[model samples]
Target: MNIFSLEGKNAVITGGGSGIGLGIAKTFIEAGAKVLIIGRNEEKLREAKLSLGDNCSYKSFDVTNLDAIPDFVTETKSNLGNVDILINCAGTHLKKYAVDTTDSEFLQVLNVHLLSVFALTREFSKVMIKRQKGSIILISSMTAIMGMKQVVAYSTAKTAILGLMRSMVAELAVDNVRINAIAPGWIDTPMLHKATDNDLPRKTKILNRIPSGKFGMPEDIGYAALYLVADASKYVNGVFLPVDGGAAGGF
Candidate 1:
């Protein structure tokens, strides 16, 4: 038996049109899962679906539309037959310092990263629990575990995700529905380039601290996500696995 296989699985990945989410969707499709990728941009979603081929589908929806999530979940489950896995990788990054950050800005970050995540988790876990099977991966950040500057709002939301994962474990684990988090290190994604391209000092500092001496690839995170969702990791639950090229422990 192939313990790492995701055959016969149906997965829904938010923000799966690009970056780490797209990488995860690609990996899952390669592993024999039918994946539905969701994002706000219909064009990007269409492109992702085309690139991913027939095994993949896409939906254009914003995660911040909290009220629409329940209906969206129902429709998704109906279309997929049954959702066996979920990856909440939809997020936004703010590079503002705390002094300049406004109340609405903080709430907006929380709205997408924290609130919407809980709503989706709540809705999906209901189905997962009834079947006594499911695996959920929350895309956390390196900011959740370590400190970084000019991202106070982003950091706060990511930090809350850890607490959310831990607190939900007590209930979700009882029904065999595993929930875990992936704290990706600095990956070479457009988002990363957007944040670091002009900030040479910050980028250089980040590179020097990493033992691997290079940024991680999106597919690197994809493979880590594969391990967490595969049956091989059925015994694993409620853990935040970091895929950061050993940067989390660098000198």
Candidate 2:
């Protein structure tokens, strides 16, 4: 437990208004860390902060604004203290097929998932590098590895995340900054429900492929976040850890 304890650490999580982002923030606070969450909706962020209690606070800022990252990082540090961990979890899901997806749609997904991730990490790593310690985690997806239908843009962006992690880790590891990605399987979230409720066949296909035979909970990802952000994973870097319930490995 001591190794997993995030005592005295400061964390900033993007998309922390709900779903996996909020889940990670809750887990970090429980592990003894203070957290600052970022989101586009002020009301949602406020509700999340209330739910996560005094240890957690939030700011409203859409991560898709690549140009705003540097200023956001500066202001967050001036307000929230030095960031010891950063969780890049802000993303948009596109369920359209490759042939049907417009160029703009594809770019939108990339801008939100890929470019924003890089921009934020690069800016935050500058701060971490000077201090010589920090952890950067990316929330990738099962689409990164599996050839799932109707999510070409989403899959493309997620796969690119691993490359980004490795690229950044190569340079940051020397500064004691850890860079990693987490690929979550079919987690039970409202978003996932909406994505699948209308497509029963697609849902069945995903469930049948998963050996665990159960949908993953948000806390499953939270626990994985705990390990990576805490001292327990100080040696881990450039790894894409899957939090899927054996779905990525099953037939």
Model 2 segments more than 4 A misplaced: none
Task: Please give the CA lDDT of all the candidate structures.
Answer: 0.93, 0.91
What TM-score would you give candidate 1 relative to the actual structure?
Answer: 0.98
Q: List the RMSD of every prediction in angstroms.
A: 0.8, 0.8
Worst 10 residues of 1 by lDDT: 89-98
Local accuracy of candidate 1 as per-residue lDDT tens digits, 1-251: 48999999999999999999999999999999999999999999999999999999999999999999999999998888889999999978888889999999999999989999999999999999989999999989999888999999888889999999999998889999999999999999888998999899999999998998999988999999999999999999999998998988998
Residue-by-residue lDDT tens digits, candidate 2, 64-118: 8888899999999999889999999986778887899999999999998999999
Q: Alpha carbon lDDT of residue 100, candidate 1? A: 95
TM-score of 2: 0.98
